[model samples]
Target: MYHYTAIQWIFFFYFYCFFGWCFESTYVSLKSRKLVNRGFCRGPFLPLYGSGAIMMLVVSMPFQDNLVLVYIAGCIGATVLEYVTGVTMEALFKVRYWDYSKNKFNFQGHICLGSSLAWGGLTILMTEFIHKPIEHLVLSIPDSILTPVTLVLTALIGADFALSFKAALDLRDVLE
Candidate 1:
């Protein structure tokens, strides 16, 4: 079991958010043959990824020794989060950021079997491979530096989310 300070957890979340954005943007840009900032926020962050990473960590805590259990837990947890997020975002913005309507075994275009299975694999990869180095790096940082950095990042991301939320609402009005 890994223990982290609140600041450390926050830092991990932000790091994963940026990482997710990079991965997503690159994939999207390659597919479209153009530069595309992929995420709800204008900044290089994806709240869904951050939240999913955190959820994976939390859900896999008890079953860390058993990869199969970890996979199951991740599938259930991530799918629920994805579904709820998709539903809420569509309701608020009048647009679907992701739609699995065409995918086989999708529920309300929000969650799908393939995505859920992939989430399970991602959870195992994250817990077994990705997090160790990140954990070490975060642990090495002194509180004096980490605290102030986290505070600044929190403020910046909060502002970005607020702006993005407002823009989404405005877009919803236009769509309506």
Candidate 2:
């Protein structure tokens, strides 16, 4: 199993969050014909992507040599994460961010087999081909540069969360 420093994991979390936001925003914009954040966070971060990526990384570490197992497990794990995220967001904010109602083999419009496989397949490719080099690059950064950058990002994310949470609460109250 691969073990990463806490700092490295932090780096991965933030990187994946922003990356997810970019991908999601672009895809949603293409579909809706307008720009959209496509993220739960007010900032350019997707917590779900952060969670999913790190979850798969840690989960796949144990099966480093077993590509097939990693693929299967990553798919199932991500799918479950997606479903839970959808349900939790709705339950908490009285909103559903995305619906898979029209997708085949979807459960409660939360998760579909097609998307699950796509996520899993992507996980496999990332874990096998991309993560190691990225991890190496992340680790190579001197602490002098890495620490301050990480600190700034954490502060910004915290501020965004606080403001967004307050707004969500106000909106929820209004809806109620």
Candidate 3:
């Protein structure tokens, strides 16, 4: 029943990316006793989190009345996304961003049951409490500014992803 325009979706993506980055960095910083930019992109964003949120938002649209189903779907969807992203990143970057090997019920340290359940619980919270207000806020922006902002943000995100990937691929120094 909730329909979002493309521009609204773009804003949602950016909003979630920055929010995820903040959540991740702060959590890591507290754990390490030092600040950390805990995101794949060099910018203050995390595409994986953003993509995961968007995917769940879309997937859970039909299950609005069924919170339990939404939560279960989120568990599976986020776990798959996390696993695939972990495999692809390790293969491409030759770096492990995260490892859950110490955790119980982890699959190749890529997807863990704890994290999956957390994702599901968060999905329920987001779908039930957060997303509607966010959608309203995003769509409230006037078209005159929304289009330009979305376009600019999209370009910046694209460039950030490319540059970060390029940095990860920099193995010449190691080879030497």
| Clashes per candidate (backbone, < 3 Å) | 0, 0, 0
Cα lDDT of model 3 by residue, 27-128, tens digit = 999999999999888999999878888978987888888999999988888888889999998888777788999999999998899999999998888787
The residue pairs found clashing in candidate 2 are none
Q: Candidate 1: misplaced stretches above 4 Å?
A: none
- The CA lDDT of each predicted structure is 0.95, 0.86, 0.86
lDDT string, candidate 1, 7-76, tens digits: 9999999999999999999999999999999999999999999999999999999999999999999999
- Assess every candidate by TM-score: 0.98, 0.92, 0.93
Best by lDDT: 1
RMSD of every prediction: 0.6, 1.5, 1.7
Ranking by TM-score: 1, 3, 2
In model 1, state the lDDT of residue 48: 94
Q: Assess candidate 3 and give its TM-score to the true structure.
A: 0.93
